[model samples]
Target: MTRISQTTRLEKVEHIVGSGSGLLDFAVKGENGYDTWEGNEDADWTVEDVDSVQNVEEDRYIMYPEGDYFICEIEADTEERNSGPVRCWCE
Candidate 1:
């Protein structure tokens, strides 16, 4: 994953899509704490067999051919007008 875990903070947003919606449920990382375990520190998060990013959720950690990555976070835009980019960290 990018060495950006400690640098990036979850931006201020009005409507953040949380870990619910029956999505892939792994360890619940808060907005401030979600940056951990995404780099090369050897994580303790659970693993799921997701084939690709399209089948993943915002809370699930998956092992792919490249490696593992935090689930793509779907959050609202600046004005909560629409969905933002699906973002995640990997190793």
Candidate 2:
């Protein structure tokens, strides 16, 4: 039997916002945090990949109307104020 190897990179990641409808594509962000990776104003603030309401501290994420997802690092963690760069919200 012959074995073939393929490169593993840029997998599609879906970060579900408050609801499970909104998806976040890590392709534009480079997978997970291993590779650090945009943006809107007056847009709604949302969280993705949250395990549970009690576990909101981890897996912090935010999505835009244009389906752009990003890592939202809020200073207070109580507000949607981001302290880091976000995903691309292209319209």
Which candidate tops TM-score? 1
How much is the lDDT of residue 85 in candidate 2? 30
Candidate number with greatest lDDT: 1
**How high is the CA lDDT of each candidate model?**
0.30, 0.30
Q: Taking the candidates one at a time, how many backbone clashes does each contain?
A: 2, 2
Q: What does candidate 2's lDDT look like per residue over 8-89, in tens digits? A: 2222333323222222223234434332221224324344444333223345443333244433431212122222233322
Q: After superposition, how far is residue 16 of candidate 1 from its true place, in Å?
A: 15
Error of 2 at 40 (Å): 2.6
Clashing pairs in 2: 15-24, 38-86
